[model samples]
Target chain A: MANDSDGIDIDYVANLARIALTDQEKERFSGQLGDVLKYIEKLNTVDVSGVEPTAHAFPLENVWREDAAEPGFPVETALKNAPAVRRNMIAVPKVVE
Target chain B: MSDPLYYRTASALSRELEAKKISSLELVRAVIERTRAVDGTVGAFISFDEDDALARARASDARREGGEALGPLDGIPVGIKDILAVEGQPLTCASRMLGDFVSPYDATAIGKLKAAGAIPWGRLNMDEFAMGSSTENSSVKTTANPWNTDCIPGGSSGGSAACVAAGEAPLTLGSDTGGSIRQPAALCGVVGMKPTYGLVSRYGLVAFASSLDQVGPFAHTVEDAAILLQAVAGYDRRDSTSYKTDIPDYRAALQENRGPWKLGIPSEYFGEGLDPEVEKAVRAAIDFYRKEGCEIVEVSLPHTEYAVGVYYIIATAEASSNLARYDGIRYTHRSSEATDAIDLYFRSRAEGFGEEVKRRVILGTYVLSSGYYDAYYLKAQKVRTLIRGDFLKAYNQVDALLTPTTPAPAFRKGEKTDDPLRMYLSDIYTIGANLAGIPGISIPCGFSGDGLPIGLQILGRPYQEADLFAIARRFEEAHDYHAKHPGL
Candidate 1:
């Protein structure tokens, strides 16, 4: 219905994911992702209407630990690989003027 | 001393090291030298810090000298897949995105391994973010199949298997989401085992797919895999998904007699796209179990056909969320082409990821988008439950399920690179084990006409890894397949 790109638009999805694709990638991905989507259409045929979704293979209650803070990784170790570090803290581009 | 130390199993090396016939330093040096000599063509390693490895080895030797030995894995050289963090070492995940990202701490599995005195040797290669069936998707290196240089070693644990097969490392850890471990082990002609989903900790291991992703071992023999699994399998609070259950010594479990238990041969796995030779080999393995007094039953995992589809949707969806950490502000590759934060995210990711990764991320975003989330993601998850139910029902009759690890042996490099769908289908048989949270081991079953190896996958019920090890050991001890290493 509405200029079908296999039921979902690719360009908008890529934008949401924050990935910049070239014009060629956009076309290739549109066709390729369309094919994958079509293949997955086979799932609609299966009678899973009543079945519950299993987000994890093994479902367990969230584990909690003791309330004492152990000597964790040092600040230097944390900032060791920062692409932009100033004053032992990660420096990011300023958001507001 | 006749065979190189790198070729020897960690179990054997352990015995030798304990008996003082060889020191850890000597063993480490021998393996390092072997890796240096052969890794030029195998491309199994992305980084091998000789000084760091030696320092670890020397420390292990000092402990041993002081009569403070750890355990069976003491001083054994083990390769870590780059996805598993090693403190002070670059956690590349074989992607340019994290090329400069140094881990602040070791993975839970790595910590267990270090406590057991394993020398974490090098960062092995994998598919970028463990997305592809072949290591050709590696953003950093192209690891060749050690058996035949032209063909691919299966992936995304290709380098872990290849390095072991090439005698570059005795044992290595790999992560299997669909079939990254077992498939590569099959293609590279070795033993690889994926524990039940929560059997090992995932903390500090870069996430690909949270539910299906599991850390496992690649080894030359079942016993070696069991030993390595023993060291890493346990409860860790850091990984909430890790099962807090009694840990069994997998090596001790290997000695258990594989009895009159029924073995299931799933009819679906041997269906249409199955290779004749691989089917023959796997069927012969089934018959071999029968001859060894195990009952053979023709069981059905009816939803096996939908495993690949379900796996792609779920794995990519999880990956889309997991990989959102790599923005320009963090400890990874930054794009100099960006003028703003939003542009920074776009440019950094586009430049950082490889073709396959970008494709999956886009596909994932599409499925989880507004109108399609229920149609795709939720539908796939429900199908996943049906798939899991199939295994649970089949386990009602059989103790374990048998199938070919892959449809065919290793294909020549560049053969299936173009078609993403065709490549995804290579994981057909092995994907079901992961979806069900069942333990699966792929051992060297036979050789193809091309001299490539075939693997027989044995899938066991969840938390029955010890029994799986016992069954695998039974087959391994009876056959000479594990003894036949690839001639590199």
Candidate 2:
């Protein structure tokens, strides 16, 4: 959980993002993102006291649709882009090995 | 040089088609020939099928011959930004991850375009996952500004704008999430409109920032933009966010709603970093409105400086979440160098994404991570509320705000490539509208001394695109800026 002086822990963040980065990327991004973070620090000047956070421009709630069964993309069509397919399902590397 | 059929506006082409003076087949061929001729230098399209486009044009001609034309857009070919799902066509988003991916079904917008008999043309390039301002982030190829081949077409919708400006297509569609559509449209000197959030369905658009992302049109004229907007705009049950509102006749609104309307000039937009030429052109546009009997007022949107910071946090945070669907197991790129399931995810993404994408994903993950969530993410949302409030407060005094679409015209390629922060500032003016969920349009106003195009932006109240179009049309008709095409 320890972070660099820029307040960003690139290794930890990249790991959490589940993307492996080369050593060069880690260095380059750390410097670039550090500069960006420094610029973003300007947000601290704005007083947001008691201000409500807006998650959406116009937040919609309880958008209910008909709960009826309808045809979707056929399994073959859905699996058309899979790297590997077996028995009509996407095949993946072993998870529990 | 005389204007070719390829450079005609969609509205003009529609009139000629109705008069039977031209066939959709002939028009499509001209566009295909134009694309083949200039695309070598412009690099506007990632891929296009001449045979498929020709066939669709023939179908439109057949429908017209039988006295059953769909609409004004019927028989016109519209270039599609590669991010949208065009069923059975490539949907790359200009990224390596989906390099081989073909859409299984049409996006709601694409379906609507097809229903209008508008042929879905080529796959236009964009910033990989619509993450960058310049199309340079595109893994495919950089789309050059058609005006000057060395300058970058402002993007992630650069290809969409460049195609129309280069006369390759009369109309095209681009999604604006923090100025993706407007900036490029401004840089490329075409009419690019980002409708009120949820005004157009996002069912098929690849999400970057869900709240900020809205699909819009890039066209040669304000009226052409209106025509394209009319075809694909409306509520879709599939996209819960698609607002249910009265869809007006935007083209008719151009002539009908001619105004002696009130306009505002936000003081913050005219400050430093704005190029002199861009300022001069936009100021001239404002003076035109004043001369036309419209009351002009100086307004303040105090949170203008904070827009870019707020956008990067919110947009990248959303992008990080949305792009999680691109795991190696499914349709996206798979890594052969994986030892296990977890290894596959890491290696595939690391290899597939470009530098900017990785940077944003990392920044997003950090801000949303456990300890920093409230500090960065929540605080940004609150600031976002303030930004939205600033625009609404101004709207009470003015009908709409007029400003420079971009701080400057298109810059030479590689100028800002090394500096990501500098690149983000290029979207400074257009981001406010998206954050506020309001409608905004960028129309060709004038050109820089270097001959690059500059744009004038007009922002309107939510769902009031008629007024927005009318305001822009006033200036468009006053001058022949929209009539000027890139010398490509």
Candidate 3:
């Protein structure tokens, strides 16, 4: 993978994603990420001015299910995989004063 | 009959069950025993619940004895890629992020499978979070190609393909975000399909990239794949993306003899980086179609080279958004050392994610960030439209397109892991279909000189999976590649 000197700051990207990477990962991924980005440079040259961006493969519009309330997962089942639980609710570290 | 029963196709097993010559319990036992015998080397399953599977099989046998058989998939032993929830089963997605998590409910596909009396038995291995091209990225299991333990069964559906190929399971469900199912199926010498994006419901499939992610099946025969597809395809209220159109009888479609179909050969797919042997095998398959009186026309998808780049931008952007929920908040692994929420988010994600996953997240976040969004993500989406238009335009002239499922057969383990770009290119030939929101199937066409299996890919218009499957069975019925198995 070439450096390409894309001037991209990987640490900033990692920060936005809230992932703490070791210094080793930062150095290695910087070059690897650059190579991946360089490949996308081909997209910059394509004339896509009038093209409509297709977000879904299908052209269908919004589909709504019956609004009637239905049975949902049981409380215990909902909380089963929670890393921290307090009285059947997910426990999170205090965020605000 | 001791072990040969394990190697039979689901169709054959169903026949024996219908004839009352064998019970579902007997079939389950044979497959479980085979798993125990060979899975240590194959590493095809993340978890196998032998007791529960046998109980389910016993119930299926009870139903059949009462003359209440369900459907084609009844009494079948199937492996499920860990990405889909199967109620009370471990839903790890072969990742550490969801460590110890057990699904509380079955996914829509699993619900349909259960309704058809399919005994979903094992948690098949996959690339962690379905992120890599090889199953080596799985934190819990290192799945190997049953064809040769030294080589990879292409992934992130490696375990699903390997299990079917190794005779451990007659059928398995695998999710393809970008050729995950088809690539591995090609490498393992089986059949794998990716239905039109909206054709199969993705409800309960752990999202890697929502738009590209679809649940399909891996089987030893194309007809069996059709059976599995029929059992699972339809409208689902749970999935907004699932198409509401009437479901067609795929097996009946196979019998329709919609032959002499016009096929397109994409010249771009055969250029540089294609293995010479793979090229020969795929071309020979095309020649076979030509001999069947099917018109083969040379077609061009000029923007094919930009697919991987455009795919990464959009797929990673969606993945970045979807994965944000795993910030050690409600469900999943949390960092034990964190004293605050912010610290926990960073440390937990950093520790739980594998290398490839982290790289994708970072790349995705960067592309969608404030200034780069227009330069990357949005631009990629526009390019995506062009890519889709490319397929639509080419489809106006042909009923289907034929190409190699992969650039080559499965490579040796650890061969391209360090080179991320090199690994991403492993899916080069198959990503165009996903980007275009169409359906594609991979069938074993021939073998590489070294004895590894090669695959032929057939792609069709959206919701035209039946056409793709019809042609697949046509070519499949004419060859013995689908019948050959690895010497496991």
Candidate 4:
């Protein structure tokens, strides 16, 4: 598992997170990453027999509520906190080039 | 009158309010004054509206005068964690990115609080997006533990916990993604409950990791916590994930009809990483419970040690997807000098989020990404099943599981800030409850030699919060853990 690095570059992680890390922070995090990975690897040793995987920590069955639409916050009031809005919708920089 | 009104529990203040001994407006004024006095020292609040709180308090008093029925939490001033949206209030998750962002609407929990006549005192500080275990990760400022000014209050809900611990507010609402509520409650020496997931509505709570996040209350006493839970819990149509079940009267459950409960003592919870001092205090608390006729049985939750690994993978993977909305365009912070729109999305988020937040986002992305999905995220979910089964197997023999809320009591500020993995391990014992979607509460059990608080966590079966509260109340009655307050 230690050698199964599919180009998991530290820079790639930093870039994805959008944080510019110092060389030292990167080195330190890399070592910490190894420790975390090693710890998680221990989970591979557990045996499961006839275990039904659960998504939530509680037993939740069909959670359908009445479909009646209730009064909601006015759109104008909702958009009041938006940093960028245009024509009643939240505006963002156009993603596609 | 010299005593701080903010420190008084909701249960205590409600009786006064009901009897008209102290008007709700007077309580609001007292809280506002106290908040102003200590906010600078503790960094408990982000935004406070004294006028608004007073207005609500006046209305509450008017209702009382008119002989109108009041809710369980009527006239109580409560702190809302920054992550929970309160209508027209700045809902910054203590992050720079959302500094200017105000909520257009209230979160379901806040809405419930308002309906019950609880006044919104203000927004409290938190780990940005509820990320860190220390409130230090808040982009704005650090919230000091009221117990010791130099020490951390414990995080994500640090500000909420500190306010309640320090008497800023008797009751505050905090969300637990992974021990955010319980760990902080333990560190600050207060009662915090993470109800069975889906028990509380999550609508309008800015999602961190949808599956793991559940809003709960932090209060001065177990009864107050139960009452607050009663106010905010139940099925909500607005939140699809909310459980569709009748809300039980938690206050009634705490009235003590049941007794001599069976408590499970899992050995893994007491092993290696536990501090000797914490173990000693917790052991004493257990002995007190045993004297109260509660049977303590040693049990094994074999998958318990694997909780931390499974939690990070599942929580981070969900976080990565949930936080994708913050691309610098729609919400709070936007970056300049975007060569184009795509660059704006990348650069804005890059600049807006902090180091720990970024690390988790990256780790989340990697786990959820194509190549590693099966090995990491999928495997974690499967392991999550095993973890839940372990709890179920133990519950079949015992009523509730007892463990130390945190491996150790609160540490000094910046003690483990540099070491991320070590910091993550702090939530080890508490994380499994969240992953398994069960209810857990952290109540002050005892104090360490240096006088820091020690917390005992009580974990119960799904939707069995009433039983959990019953056991906790028995323990509280036997030992005066709730009576010990910080010197602040």
Ranking by DockQ: 2, 1, 3, 4
> How close to the true structure is residue B39 of candidate 2, measured as C-alpha lDDT?
97
* Candidate 4 C-alpha lDDT tens digits along B129-149: 999898888998999988788
Best by DockQ: 2
User: Alpha carbon lDDT of residue B165, candidate 2?
Assistant: 94
lDDT of 1 at A16: 91
Off-target runs (Cα >4 Å) in candidate 3 are A1-5, B1-3
Model 1 docking category: medium
Model-by-model DockQ, in order: 0.65, 0.69, 0.65, 0.51
Location of the lowest summed lDDT over 10 successive residues in candidate 3 chain B: B1-10
Candidate 1 chain A: 10-residue stretch with minimal lDDT:
A1-10
Writing each residue's lDDT as its tens digit, candidate 2 over B1-488 gives: 25799999899899999989999999999999999999999999999988889999999999999999999988999999999999889899999999999999898999999999999999998999998888999999999999999999999999999999999999999999999999999999999999999989999898888989999999999999999999999999899888998899888888789888999999999999999999999999999999999999999999999999999889889988988888888899999999999999999999888889989988888889898888788989999999999999999999999999999899989999999999999999999999999999999999989999999999999899999999999899889988997777
Residue pair clashes in candidate 1: none
lDDT of each: 0.89, 0.92, 0.91, 0.85
Off by over 4 Å in 4: A1-7, A11-29, A48-52, A59-75, A86-97, B1-4
- On lDDT, the stronger of 1 and 4 is 1
Model 1 misses residue B186 by how many Å? 0.4
Give the lDDT of residue B266 in candidate 2. Answer: 99
lDDT of 3 by residue, B35-59 (tens): 9999999999999899889999999
